[model samples]
Target chain A: AQSVTQLDSHVSVSEGTPVLLRCNYSSSYSPSLFWYVQHPNKGLQLLLKYTSAATLVKGINGFEAEFKKSETSFHLTKPSAHMSDAAEYFCVVSPIAGKSTFGDGTTLTVKP
Target chain B: EPEVTQTPSHQVTQMGQEVILRCVPISNHLYFYWYRQILGQKVEFLVSFYNNEISEKSEIFDDQFSVERPDGSNFTLKIRSTKLEDSAMYFCASRDGLAGEVGELFFGEGSRLTVL
Candidate 1:
């Protein structure tokens, strides 16, 4: 079984400040991890994915995440937060190709 | 870019009525999935389909829930009897299944089901 835990339910940051969202996972085997963002009333958009290729993955909108195996963590980070970045983010773990487990989600609020 | 699309953005139904949610996945995608999220809750996976059969499903997908790919393009989820608890936003997602491809899912806007 694979599961992901998002440490924070909500996080607020001022514009131009660094942003961090924490996630941890438990999987039986080497797993595939992903970060997805969902805006209000919109579908989820893939931010980035870790497929055991790179320890640090860069994604769109200046977002990035580092995959740490020992710590079982894949935390999303951005050098600076923008108002457009305010949304709900999910950490997902997949044991196989099609099945996925999503974290509770972290609501990000960017204040201008 | 090609994207998944869902129909009936919102539906209101009386309890015990059957509701079917429809989706059209990306043309070349081979894997299809259904997920649901209650208001303010985490998204939950309901089922995954490949080769016109279910590959995996969650415990929440009970006897009352079923899925089908009736045609080449349409994927549908049918709930036999709706309950108030079933009210949520149902999302349909698809993934390109090329071997060695990363497991990235493309999602539809979702259908909001309201069981009254």
Candidate 2:
């Protein structure tokens, strides 16, 4: 079985400042990791995905996450936070060929 | 871009009443799934369907739940009986990929079910 843990239940950042959301995973085999964003009352939107390639992956809307195997972490980051960035972020992990698992999710609040 | 779509954005039902939530995945997608999220809880997988059969399912998917691809376009999830705990947001997703390979699964906005 695979699982993901989002370190924080909620994270707040000042607009125009940096943003970081932490996530860790436990998987038996190589895993595929993803970051998705869901705004209030909206569906989830894919942000970035790590499919066993470059450890540092870039995603839409100026967001990125690094897949660190030794640390078993996939932390999402951005240099600047926009009010639009405020939303619920989910860290997902999947096995080589199995069902996907989602974290409890981290709600990001960008304060201007 | 083609995306998944669901019907009845919100439905209210009495306990013990049957309700069917519907979805239409991407036209060429081969795999389909149903997931639910209780109020302020993590999303939980219910079932995955492929090749006209179920590929996998979670323990939460039991005798009360059934999935069907009634036609070439529509995928529906029927709950035999609703309970108060059944009030939640149900999401439908679809992916087209083979084992060991990966593909994106598009998701719908979600259908909120409120069982009284």
Candidate 3:
């Protein structure tokens, strides 16, 4: 069984301030972790993924996440938040290619 | 930069009516999946299809739900009878065949089904 948990349901950050969204996962096998962002009326876009290569993964839109095996955590972070960054973000865990378990999304609000 | 495509972006139907959601995955991709998000809820896994067969499915994929890969490219999910609770945003996704790398699934815009 595989599952993901998003610690925060909503996060508010000021423009140019830092952003953080916590996520944790449980999987029987080696897990693949992903962060996806869904802008309103748009498809879910892949922000980053951790396969087993590097602990630190950099994604598009200036976002990054670190895969911590000890903690079973994959937390997303960004140094500076932009207005455009406001959206619903999901944390996903996959035991295999197509089989995935998604976390309740975290809605990020960037205040100007 | 190929993308997944879905039809009938939004559909409203009466309860107990049948609904068929269609999708066209990336040409070279070998894995496909269906997921749904109820209003303000977490995205839930429905089913996964690979090699012309269902590889795995979640408990949410009950007898009322069926998935098919017809004509090689089109993947479809059919709800035999939809309920008010079935109303949600359904997403179709596909990933490549590479087994070594972390499979990155590309998603469609989603089909919003509103069951009345």
Candidate 4:
């Protein structure tokens, strides 16, 4: 079984401030983790993924996440948050050939 | 920059009515999936298809839900009878099935179904 937990349901940040969205996972086997962002009324877009390569993975829009095996965490971070960064983010876990399990999602609210 | 495409951006239907959501996945991708997200809720996996058949499905995908790849380019989800709780945004996604390639899925804008 594979599952993901997004620690925060909502995270508010001021424009230009740092952003962090936490996620943790439980998988019986080695897992592939992903972070996806969904803008209002838009499709879910892949932000980044970790497949046991680098511990730190960089994604589009200046977003990055570090895969911490010991902590069982993959927390997304951005040095500076932009107004456009306001969106709902999901953490997902999938085995090599199984369905992906999604987290409840974290709604990032960027205040200008 | 290949992407997935879905049809019927928004559909309004009465209870017990049937709904069909269509999608065109990225060419050359061999794995397909259908997911849904209720308002303000997390996305839930419904089913995954490969090699012209279903590979896996979730509990939410009851007998009322079905998927098919009719005509080779179009993947579709059919609901025999939609209930009010079935109202949600349905998303289509595809992934390359090449060996040793653990690729991310490409998604479509999604079809919103409103059951009344």
Candidate 5:
């Protein structure tokens, strides 16, 4: 089965600084990857997704990620952090065009 | 921009009591799904439904768990006997049957279940 692993349980970044949340996956086939953000007391919102089409996919709120087949990773990155970006981020993977398999999740804290 | 919707943001029930969580997916969506997160645990897929039948299910979805799309808009998950361990956030999600295509599953705010 396809699965995802988030390297960090939590991450803290200062405003205007770069942010990185690491994620890795194990799949037999080229998988579909996604990043979702959820604030406290709110529903989850999709950040970005990487299908087979693009290696580097851009997402909302200035977040982006690169699907590296050789590295087996799809790490979420941001050039500048904002206070509103503070939320629980989950890395999910799906079998080739299949249902999503979510990771344990990484909580992001942005300090202004 | 139609989205999935879930009912009863929070429900409190006693152990052994049956609880049904309701969901209304996007109007044109064809596939429905149910997932659960046991407070701080990973999100686990419970079951996937399509064409008014179950297409897939996980081991966690045992005999006690059941799903049904009673009418046109309502998708429901029913637990025969609730347990304390069942107290967690149950999320309802849906996809527009674009499997071979490029659409992702949209999730609802989730129904928080608390078994007392």
Candidate 6:
């Protein structure tokens, strides 16, 4: 079985400040983890993915996430938050053959 | 760049009415999936289709729900009878790769179904 947990339902940050959204997962096999962002009324866009290649993965729009094996965590981070960064982010875990499990999502609210 | 496309961006229907959501996945993609997200809720997997048949489905995909790749370039999800609880944003996604190969999924904007 595979499951994902986004620790924060909502995270508020001021523009130009650091941003962090925590996520954890449990999978039987080596999992493929992904971070997706959805703007209001928009489709889910792939931000980045970790397939046991690099522990630190960089994504578009200045976003990045580090996969911590010991912690079983893949937390998204941005050096500086921008107003356009406000959106809903989802953490997903996909096994080798089955369906992917999605987290409840974290709403990032960037205040200008 | 190629992307998934869905029709009926938003549909409103009365309870018990049938609804068919359509999608055109990226050409050359082999795996397809349907997912839904209720208002302010997490996205949930409904079903996955590969090679013209259902490869896997979640419990939420009951007898009332059916998926079909009736012809080339079109994938459809039919609800024999929709309920108020069925109102949600349905997203269609596709991936191009063999099993065990890690690939990112391409998603459509989603069809918002409102069951009254």
Best model number under DockQ: 6
Candidate 1, residues A29-82: lDDT per residue as tens digits?
Answer: 898899999999988999999998989999999999999999999999999999
Local error of candidate 3 at B5, Å? Answer: 0.2
- Deviating ranges (above 4 Å) for candidate 1: none
lDDT of 2 by residue, A59-106 (tens): 999999999999999999999999999999999986644467889999
RMSD each, Å: 1.1, 1.2, 1.1, 0.8, 1.3, 0.9
Relative to the unseen true structure, what is the Cα RMSD of model 1? 1.1
How does candidate 3 score on lDDT? Answer: 0.93
> Candidate 4 regions off by >4 Å?
none
> Which scores greater on DockQ, model 3 or model 4?
4
Error of 4 at A45 (Å): 0.6
- List per-prediction Cα lDDT, in the order shown: 0.94, 0.91, 0.93, 0.95, 0.89, 0.94
Model 3 stretches astray by more than 4 angstroms: none
Q: What is every candidate's C-alpha DockQ against the true complex, given to 2 decimals?
A: 0.73, 0.61, 0.75, 0.80, 0.59, 0.80
Model 2 residue A1 CA deviation in Å: 1.5
Per-residue lDDT of B41 in model 2: 87
Supply the DockQ value of model 4. Answer: 0.80
Residues B70-98 of candidate 4 have per-residue lDDT tens digits of 98899999999999999999999999886
lDDT of 3 by residue, B36-99 (tens): 9988888888999988999989899999999999899999999999999999999999998886
Q: What TM-score, computed on C-alpha atoms, does each candidate reach?
A: 0.97, 0.96, 0.97, 0.98, 0.95, 0.98
Query: Backbone clashes in each candidate structure, one number apiece?
Result: 0, 0, 0, 0, 0, 0
Off by over 4 Å in 6: none
User: What's the lDDT for residue A57 in model 2?
Assistant: 98
What's model 5's TM-score? 0.95
- Measured as a fraction from 0 to 1, the native contacts recovered by model 6 come to 0.76
Q: Candidate 2, after superposition: displacement of residue B108 in Å? A: 0.5
* lDDT per residue as tens, model 1, B30-94: 99999999999999999999998999999999999999999899999999999999999999999
